[model samples]
Target chain A: MRTIGLEDIDDIALGSSLLGSGGGGDPYMGRLEAIAAVKEHGPVTLLDVDEVPDDWTVAPICGVGAPSVSLEKGTNGIEYPKVRAMMERMLDTKLDAFLLSEAGGMNSMVPISAAARAGLPLVNADGMGRAFPGIQQDTFTLNGVSTNPFVIADEKGNCTVLYTIDNDWTERIGREITTASGGQVTTLASPMTGAKMKTSVVKGTVDYAQKLGRIIRTASDAQGEEPEAFFLRESGAMRFFKGKICDVLRETRDGFNFGKVTLEGIGEDKGREAVVEFQNENIYAEVDGEIVATVPDLICLVDSETFVPVTTENLKYGKRVLVVGLPCDPAWRTEGGLELAGPRWFGLDVDYVPIEELAARRTDA
Target chain B: MRTIGLEDIDDIALGSSLLGSGGGGDPYMGRLEAIAAVKEHGPVTLLDVDEVPDDWTVAPICGVGAPSVSLEKGTNGIEYPKVRAMMERMLDTKLDAFLLSEAGGMNSMVPISAAARAGLPLVNADGMGRAFPGIQQDTFTLNGVSTNPFVIADEKGNCTVLYTIDNDWTERIGREITTASGGQVTTLASPMTGAKMKTSVVKGTVDYAQKLGRIIRTASDAQGEEPEAFFLRESGAMRFFKGKICDVLRETRDGFNFGKVTLEGIGEDKGREAVVEFQNENIYAEVDGEIVATVPDLICLVDSETFVPVTTENLKYGKRVLVVGLPCDPAWRTEGGLELAGPRWFGLDVDYVPIEELAARRTDA
Candidate 1:
């Protein structure tokens, strides 16, 4: 077990956004919320998967809805605990700890604040090793955790408990409820015993996020070097391209941001054009008309100079950024996980291929 | 005590629509579904409010959404019990009887079918003495029945449990979820004990619907009189005008049919014009540039010749019709009740004057 201090928030928040692959919402607000909560409530313990007892209940708390809406509708900081309380009511059992729904962007620290404020431990693992746009795009479903009986509460004290037959239905119905409840909500789902969570969640992703955050922070302070190159090497992410965002098409509808960004290559990657498509996160990326990255894999966009992650909602024209690709956890590479979050699931025409192979092919060419 | 048999569905369906004030849904589908259930399950026992035990749990089961959607998205005969079961799960207790959510339209018969299939008793009372499009416009709300902990289920077996602070929040959020879940959903809410049910609901409305239905059925078979006159006097309603519909401005949106119907006078009511506005149920009416009716009062539309109730959705051009108005129950006329469902609540510029008072003024003129 480890204690998450207020100082750890910056690195985790930055790393979480980097792992978000340009989705999971911007981390700025989450960082602020977490810092305030930790300062007020003191540091929080983060239990490892095995550290939790077999019979103890566990779940994740995260923000769910269109990422852009967070800016317009400032939250009351009440929905986080309400969601957890609602989950407890639904189950008639208290959760032993709050698990990270995703180790990406703002969501990663949402649980940190929730856990700290509630005096509940935070689990040092996550459902999605990295953030994915859709709720069903997690290892929990692939590992046989039921998505039934989750709680979603909006800032207005309006709450809804969702029960669906499958994970897909959870997304379909939950998204609609989120949209209906003013485009933003807090959700806690997949409640299970620590035994079930041990087998289902991606282990140590929170610590990985902290490590990535440390790399970015330390590298960010050094001058006269490409911080992104250092970030890529340390993150095991291969450099896809360095380019200026030429065009961005975006629309927020049905409680999600659906868009794509076109990148005009710069530096050593000159004369090559890349297109990255997203539904809240970068799901597919291609360069010079060749597929270089596709989910279930991480396709991260970070500022070229500072290595700070740029979320899909924050992507804009003329932003010089680095397109970085990293392999997803083995759980997502499985058949069920692939079907849950694959490029095919996003209605793309591309076939599934590992990020390493795609990078190797690009390098060989 | 009484039993609701399969034969009673026709009259109840017709009378229910009359009380719907031209809103509730078309009673045809509800009729067919209730009739089928009663035939399959024998009959439903209905207990009068006074006959119920103080401690027994009771609530209403009704349909929520745009009246138009029910025609296209046929139900699977599963959502009724699913809603009840969900409510039971939420409260963790078995309900003794099902109260009617509204006394008007298809909803009046929904609880009958639900009670019959579950073999539970149906209470001879309702929240809305006459249906008024929005959920918050019920006598139950004004009488202190909490609108929280309700269940909304779709035909697809997906369900949402809603918990809101006020009745208004229930409508705002519930409507959105209903719209999202294919524009129609089955809901059970305002759960209370028999003691609270007795004080909060309109007593004997179910039996009254049956009586009104029988009157309409008998009058339809009778020859050559203005049958609506008999329906009016027997049901304590007043005829506002007799005319042929000239124009209808209608749109189905946000899970409601919002519009107005204008009538050009005919026969004894010749040379007068009446315009009635509605949001789901008729909320206001004007005759010859004077306020004739406004809500928390029922403004029903029926065929002038046959006395068949015409829902707002069924209103069409050139159809000869009678405008009938009936006072809402005393529960909706109190200060709090009026504040909840009065003309001002519907954003009308006029004040709510009782139907009987308006009729008296017209007679004196």
Candidate 2:
């Protein structure tokens, strides 16, 4: 286990945002939230998934909602306590640790906040290597960890406890309640226990996020290099394309910012164009009208000059961005992953081609 | 209790689709699929919620996915059995009855297909009086019936059972699994109980759907009768406006068609414009650049000439449509209902208005 101090927040935010790939919601507020939590509660211990004791009671904590709305309705910071208390009440045991639900965006920071406040260790790995839109998308779904006894806490201090027979219904019903509660944010705690955590949590993600974050910053400062390049080097990502946002369309529905942005290629990508579709985060990145990156595969848009992350909703016409893609957890590359997040999964007709291959093509040409 | 016959299929399809208000998915396919099931297994028995014996084992069945995708992938009659058997296995009791999860679209018919084969009595009322995008929005969620031991059966005969602590996780994890299962059509059977059904269901929805279907078809056959007028006379609906779709943009994300469409007013609504947004069904409606009708109210768009229902995805530019609004269940107008489906719930800065007020304003101006 490693100790995480306040200094880790910024880097973790950047890395987690990259992993968000467009849909886990923004990490800015989450970072601020986590930093404030840490300051108030003290440093948190970050443990690898493998390091979790067999008896440790590890529960997941995260928020579900549109990032746009979150900005308008800042959180009440009460959900964590409510969910934590609910789980403890249900299981009749104190939570020994908190873990990230997904290693992307705001989700990555939630456990840190929860852990800091609860005086519990935080596991590094997440249920998903990248972000997915629903609860059933977690690797835990495959691992047979049910999302039951889950607690949803709203900003108004109203907490609803559901014991659904299945995960999908939880999402369906939760979404409606979430919408009704203002559609911005709802806190959920689920997939508890060490035995379950062993199978469900992706090992070593917390440290990975921190390490990924640190590498980008250190490499850039040391080499006077592009942060994006530093990220690509550390993560083995491939630069998909560089482009300028030409058009962006956004709408809020069912508690999400569902939108798309069209990009006209620039710089090394002068002759090409692309459209990056986002549901909170960019889920699909199409270059020259061909899908080059998709869900389950990490697709991040960064400032063309700085390589800093740019959220999908914030992208505007004429804003220059470099589209980068990284290979996801190999678990996500499996048949299940392809079926869950492949291009065809999004109604785009194409098999997934690694970003590396697309980048290699440019070099070869 | 009423015995449903083969003749009821046509009207059920028509009326249910109308009530679906462009969100419930295509009733045609659901109609045909159920018809085929009925043909093979005989007509399903429709029962009033009161008809259910206190001890009767009951389950609500429906598909969860992007409506367009559900139409394309097709049910092929696999999900019903999967969920039925799973529920049976989990509860250790024979499912004595089946019910529609919602009264609109394919969901209304999906249970029919299952009920016919299972030889279970089908409840007339649904959890949601109309249609909603996710699981938690149902009357069941509001009524405090957990959708647990819910079974999600995919087309490939792969079934995953999720036990979420709450309803929100069900949607997320179930959607992720559905996506992983190659975007397969899925059926979920949830909140199984006789007593729970009585409290959570919208009474008489099945009969309502059937009768609504009959009215529309009969209106078309009769000379000089308007379908909207028939709906108003029978269902207390108010004519909101008449317009042609001028622009539309949408995307299918996480198994849902979520977006917005703009309408250029025509006839009584000339020179005025509106935008209708949908998450499965029309949830927000704005007229003349002002918010008119919003959620918890039935916002419907019917083909101007035929009065056939128009789904969100099917709505295209140049299609003339009559926008109508109906007061939703009194339950929806309640504080809880407003919280669940209100305009403000969707992140819009507007208060909920009754359909009558919006309709009266149109005539006054």
Candidate 3:
């Protein structure tokens, strides 16, 4: 899509939620915010990397906190442009476009809202192919970009322009502020140039999410085809499990929603059980005590019938669902990316194995 | 004291500790830092409020965190000037002098070091006549000054120029950053004009602390007089109790040392028990089941023999000490000041009757 008009918000939000892997907070709020902005300011131009000059700058306007809180307390929308303005003044330059922080759940719509409100175009790229739990889990951190000179602002108009030693400092300080400031803050961090964006981001994830959203919407409402089956075929994703959510355990601590979900298998996989673990996003999944999926691969849960994305925060008991896994961006599979956000980085006793390999083995067995 | 030479540091440190009311961390490290600063850059001029132009700018550079942590992890000294520079840049004006945040313990020495390093005069005035646990406990907050446009920085060069809606926001956000950044941060906050400083701060507190320090030192060194008696005679301070510390419990949490000290009367009042409760600064004290003193009043613990100040962080079992009560600033007795930092504000159940009244009742009975 060349432009993100009001009508595209649902598809993009839906598509991005699938990429969210059951995290990035709920996408519904972001969708509403993006729709309102587009309606008020007209359609925001969606630009390809080639459409912008090399010198153009792009930065993400994102929120940081737990899904447990952010889902309930939606953005007031003032913090968005306040952070934007502070960033512009602090950096002593004008922003040319907005870059999505991640092509996951609600965040996929955050840049849309920010760009539309600022009357600027949005580049179809993101720091992460999908959202991860930590600030250091971004492509910008992997590509040697500093998280310094960033701005964080709360809805009450309290703001701090922070400069830290590293991304770890950025995460700790930022998280502390987020948790203390009513568990949510709008942030403008890690501004990258158009030239750097080409090499430092997961490209076209915005376009991909929008396409997937469209595919799911059209197929779900169609006469013959089913949404999940269409999504599986079009996105080349593997069905990790098909079952009903038997139990879910979620606890929000230090501004993160850590959770576990147990699914009782159904359909062809009757009489089996599947377990999924998540910290803000789904991190690992096992069926009958065998490892089936793990991050940094996308592990998404969706409604069994309508193919609507169900975030980790929205997981509930007695809900029929399908567990899906998709290959992460090629960059995330690199040695550097794996070291930065792989299972070991998250304190898990597992090695980095591509989802394609794991899914191929599961199918073969 | 017209200038803060290296020799004056010991007396200031000693005297300030008396005003500390068992808070403001420990004075030894701050003394060393101030001495080194003065030795390297010569003396820092001590300016009376009237010496500065009416339009001259003044602000406080102080440390915030648990006295338990701040005492052990003394400032690296870099953070002080860094915050000062950020405040200057953000306010877009040069500071004419440094105003001590409080006239208590280590903090009183902090401004001395900061002023010497910057080659600026240090005003004899201070925001609080005694050091307090929270940022809002200062006279500036009492006088209706805003804490916006403050700067906080850590030893590692990470800094934030913060703007909050009120002092409470400033305290929470600043404390969060301080705790997360290894539990120490230097802050430059509440810049006021020379005109405001005259009415907004306690006058001649530096001189008062220095004179008290001199009384303790000379009396302890001489063979003729006992330091504690000499101190009481000179300052018109009342001796609350003479005892040996029987038990002490201190825990550093959320960047403040919460503590309790149980003292058993040793001389003149044998078989009597006294309990003191503190959060950073001494908040309440009770002797033999009678409410003796509470906050908005100074409750100091000093060595029984030498009369050297004993900070809350340094309280230990078996130490022979004298609990002294000095009158707090007259401003702190005002309705606004009492409402801001009275006993109830620190969660104490006692009302803020001046120490003079409490001591007079005990003497009469």
Candidate 4:
């Protein structure tokens, strides 16, 4: 697998936006910020956790809480340094590298920025393979890794490190501060040595992001080829529906951008109205009264013409979009996965269906 | 402060019902389970962090996610052992004691159960004087300690430990797994040593629980005294409104009992309707388009006659309930505290008003 450069992040952001469904926040600003950091510090080396040296201490870098604040307020890139310094001081040793906490939204780009700027190798994996609203939504926690000695950094340049004895306390304490900090804060936490990383971090996410990004970018550049088609070819995603956004209702409450976006279906499914409800991320997709796609699987909305991601805030009246569905990591498809990211979990009473099946049904009709 | 015995937990559970305010689930089973454990293992000692040895590690124990599950499928004493073992394994030494993560519902009682079984001292203080959802909502996390090394135990005998690099990760991962686990899991996390506990854990919560419990029990034993008056004397909580539940809409989603309970005001505030919204715990109270008692303060609902807590699920049409208001921990009333647990946080558009003031306004009218 090839490594990603700063220029490659644009494609990743675009693809991530599509994968984000209607809710990964705007990826452009996060992309720009990541690119700026990469440009200043040089391309970061992406290392598989298996390749990490046994002695190296690897820390996951990311942001927490409501994505609205993360997008609107932006990040200061301060926590990374403070966490690094504190961890080194506590252990009396220099750190080895950084890892992404997840593959969705600004958090996906945060570690890359921190890795490049800090001169540390970036791990190619994340805790959760996708986006979630809280901290403990990762496979590592499921596998028993604590998110501790966690450091929280605010734009005001205040950095506080918590060396808690347990992960729940880490969440309780961190949430209070993040809530107090107005629902968005950046941090470096859950420090583990490379040996632990191999067992815990999801392998090969960095390469996947780079490849996904590259394919989308290259396909768009080729002879009027559609970016959505390129992404479908590369990631095996299926176009579930094509429509124009008819209505969008949003409210900022509980530090989350919550509401629904309705789309009027076109083509074979013309006259069908579908509504997708969102809370920080698109959780449920319903076409008319029937459930089409639910969470734990990717339900992404791509620009009909260019395949660029159309975010929830940007989704508006008459904007044509192609809704695509991709199966989440197999782990997310488990009973545990369904419970965490399934339809019923989000308040819907439908079982999950793959985008491919939905597309096949649509095409058959 | 005087020590509390296992015998005292039942009375505390009864009194706490009044304080829980039509939420906080039913503390009876948890308290009974805890009492049984304490009776079998001997009374657990309650200690202040400052009284502990310098090197002793103190972990906070609590059940995360929906309390409804606690009523349906009782929680076994597991997380405390898992956390204690994890810490012991980490330091190659046994933990000296344990602490409650919060003071409300089964959480307050669970720690005593864990302490009794594990032969660990139970700290008198909790992270929150009452309950609020999310790991980051704790005063300890707000002050500095991030809840980490979070140990979660499921009834299926699966115990996962998460060490996120940050507190948000802890919340995310824990919540995700909690969703995966059907929303009722026990967690032992945010372990701080005795040194930090002195400054971090909210002091005297366990003893306070015992005292409050004793007051209610004693009053009832003497003359079946009103639970409301007992609460008022103990915590300075005031009677805000007397009413009957007119409407209740319940939806169990994401492991949280989220929805609204509407009360038809009686007495001086008669003819007016009030709605209190809750997610795991009550966060907002409003009456006839006016914000009454918001979060970061106590919103208790009692049986108009018995002054006992009525779980949201148990609240039925025409059930008489007294809505009592009590001051929150002054720390929560601060700007930081308000942001973390205030009314706006639960999606209401209003500033927080002290429960006392709201009660006074009612009396004045």
lDDT of residue A77 for candidate 3: 78
Error of 2 at A244 (Å): 33
DockQ of structure 1: 0.64
In candidate 1, which residue ranges exceed 4 Å CA deviation?
A72-77, A221-226, A262-266, A269-274, A287-291, B221-228, B244-249, B262-274, B286-291, B316-318, B356-365
Docking category of candidate 1: medium
DockQ of each: 0.64, 0.04, 0.87, 0.04
Query: Tens digits of per-residue lDDT for model 1 on B1-365?
Result: 98889778888898889999987788988888898889999889989999999999998889988887876776678898888888998898998999988976779877888888899999998888888878887878887788778898889988889899788888988888787778888998888999998888888988888888888787756556556656676777777889999999999988898999999999988999999999888998888988888988888998887788899888899999988888888888889988888888888878778878887888899
lDDT for model 3 comes to 0.86
**Chain A only, candidate 4, TM-score:** 0.88
Angstrom error of the Cα, residue A199, model 1: value is 2.8
Task: Give model 3's docking category.
Answer: high
What lDDT tens digits, residue by residue, belong to model 3 across residues B202-284?
88888989998898888766567666567788867778888999999999888888989999999896899899999999988
- Rank all candidate structures by their lDDT, best first, as comma-separated numbers: 1, 3, 2, 4
Question: Candidate 3's residue-wise lDDT over A203-257, tens digit each?
Answer: 8877889888887777666657666678788767788889999999999998899
What tens digits encode model 4's per-residue C-alpha lDDT throughout B126-150?
A: 8877777777787877777866566
Show where candidate 2 strays beyond 4 Å. Answer: A1-365, B182-184, B223-231, B360-365
lDDT of 1: 0.86
Pick by lDDT: 3 or 4, better one: 3
- How accurate locally, in lDDT, is each candidate? 0.86, 0.75, 0.86, 0.71
Which is the winner by lDDT between candidate 1 and candidate 2?
Answer: 1
